[model samples]
Target: MVFLVCLIFCFLAPALEAQVAVRDTVLTVRPGDSLLAIAHRLLRYSTEYTAGELVDRIKRENGLQGDAIQMGQLLDVSLSYAELLDQPVIRGTNFAARGIYITAALAGSRRMLTLADALVAAGGNTVVFDVKDRYGNLGYASSVPLALEIGAGQRAPIAQPAKMLDALHRRNIHVVARLTCFYDARLARQRPDFVPFSREGPGLWSERGKSNWVDPSLPQVQEYLLAIVREVAELGVDEIQLDYVRFPTEGNLADAVFAFDPAVVPKDRIITDFVTEVERVLEPMGVLLSADIFGVAAWGREADRRTIGQHLPDLLPHLDAVSPMLYPSHFEDGFERIDRPVDYPYYFLLQGCQRLQKLATEHDVLVRPWIQSFDYRVTDFDSLYVTEQLHGAEDGGARGWLLWNPASLYEIGFAAIKGFTDSTAATVPVKLRFPKSLGMDLTRPTSVAD
Candidate 1:
């Protein structure tokens, strides 16, 4: 009987070893903690397991078919070497990559070479091509009938949008689709009844006599933008960035009017409602949704409340990342102790970024600032000045930064920034210049030194 029992125990031991044991562990879901974060922490303890492998184990044990771990939810985690080895491999974040913006015409033509040359000159590792511009036009051919009816679809300079994405992906270059929302002039024009007009009549919404925007309070407008976003997601792009998400700023406010329906809701609820709806439709699609807010929004102080109705807390929950347009040239007087706003670019940029970073941490969102890369007010483009802005963003605890040169010219500015090598066959390594105190534990939340 003893020999038989030993034989049974030996056979069962192998099976038991393959199975994971559940154990309770205390974990504080820090700001920015996601389902991926929890898996990453567990894999750190189990040397043989990676985050992806541990995620599979956690899902199997928890009876989860999808990734949706909530903040502060205590999870039971365990893993085995054999199970881990069978799991999928995870990719590392490309920290040094910078994003570039390209227009539909440029992306489609052999002028793509010019754009590529510009990217190479600027040390850019990512390209954000416009799938839909402010006109609400699709850069590529669309199957959506509304897109055809409204004349919103186009066969871009690039024969196929998917081919462009695939080429970028092959180069290990991250591609983001820029979908301009709310300020869609084309849609508003076609459907004048849906346009936000002055109290006078059914006319177009104009800002500064240069651009026109759609009414945010309109449900039909929201649906149109969502359809474009869905089309971009299906293009196999890495991320979809929503530009002009807010109301038009520099316009005739007193003369301007809203076609906003009083029956549907209140004015305060309009912006938040639109953002929430967009997130709800986009989140489960396995793509990231990012929104651009004014630099002042990051201050958490309602400075431009009337024009740019963006409040930090309101927009935080609806986004994967928040990019504040911290262009120093745009600020008014008395910012960063500079009597002349444009003269002190570095100082204002640093201070503004710091404020924005603080707001991002409080709301548990990632900060990726749009820094000034072009010389607007200044007669000469300063390379060292650009480096200072980069330092400022890094000092303020930005995860990554992007340079904005409207014409795609960035030779001087890129040369000045540290850690970027020139576009040549034999390149020299340049040390990345980051503030020592601004150390980012890629696996953990950001913290400012006390």
Candidate 2:
């Protein structure tokens, strides 16, 4: 009998351990609290289950017969892998990204390995690759169905995404995928109904004779972008940085039209709602989300914010970080009482970063400004210029900074970072602040009405 019982125990042990591995948390119901609200609040970190599905699980787990729950009742909740990781008790380092942007061409080439080595040697730990270009082409071979149907993945530069990501991850380097939204010329051309209409004529609206922008307020557009985001996140990137997230600004805006009227929905709300939807999708997968906004948007002017559909205040709630293109060269002279803004890279960067930092703090997000690298306007652009910009960003309380050079030529910029490191680099432990999401406050549970 003892031998038979011991043999049977071995089979049961595996099943018991599997059950033990399923994590659960106990929540005390407050006034007006319901099972659905709890599920929605925790849904931000759920990867597999939807809120409604999770509610069913909660009911079955807690042995509740209905959706109703009494105040102060102890309820057992199943926690997802992402939600468990997001618990305040579980902590990890949030890497301060001292980084550079890599074009898809450079990222796919053999030079990528050499560039990674050089960047790591300089104490840089982040690399933002252009996963989707401005022309609406994917940088890698994507399996997303819409991408395949639209031929978006044709001529993909980064043919072997897994191999490239593995090489970077092995070096303890954080990888950020940069995706361009809305201004997808290829996508607009393929789906003519998605393109902006011309108020002046019946044909599609074009910016400077180029019909590159799609209506951002459309549901199909948002779903398509989210699908791309999901594919990239599953590839194990550290973050997703969205660029061109606003409406077109360069050309005949007065004659341009959108699917949604600006009067009823408003432009900022359209952008904000889209970002909120993205956050809902990404947060549950444990991926960081950020947006690149115009540098002038930092001033918080209503006209500038509405025109671009990038009101920082509305967008911050859904982002882990907000990157302002704060390159001083991009600023016009006499804009901020600073003539020859390019000559004052440090001042402009500091000012713009500081302004954004204040707003970021309210939302518990980081401000990682994009610093200039190329000599677009300044004649004296050199290694020192790069170093000064770094100092200014640091002084402005920026968490980190990213260098932007379109051609991926950063020899001078790299030298500046090396010199700057020699003078001021210090080893700091990594830590990720388990921040509050836009969902219901799980930490401080309130009444259901809240």
lDDT of 1 at 178: 80
The TM-scores of all predictions, comma-separated, are: 0.68, 0.74
TM-score of predicted structure 2 = 0.74
lDDT of 2 at 65: 89
C-alpha-based local distance difference test score of model 1: 0.62
The lDDT per prediction is: 0.62, 0.77
- The TM-score of candidate 1 is 0.68
- What is the model-wide C-alpha lDDT for candidate 2? 0.77
Supply candidate 1's per-residue lDDT for 119. Answer: 64
lDDT of 2 by residue, 1-450 (tens): 432343334323333211322344677787988887887665533332245667888899888889888998987765543212111111133447888999988887767878888998987878999999988999987888878988998888675575567667767777899999999988998998899899997899999988999999889999999999998888778789999989888898989889888888779898999889888888877888989999887778788876888877778989988888988889887664545678766666666777777778888888898989899998778887887778778867788889999999989888878888788532212121111233533223221122
lDDT of 1 by residue, 339-405 (tens): 5556555554555567666656776667777878888776555776676667667667776777777
Clashing pairs in 1: 108-157, 108-158
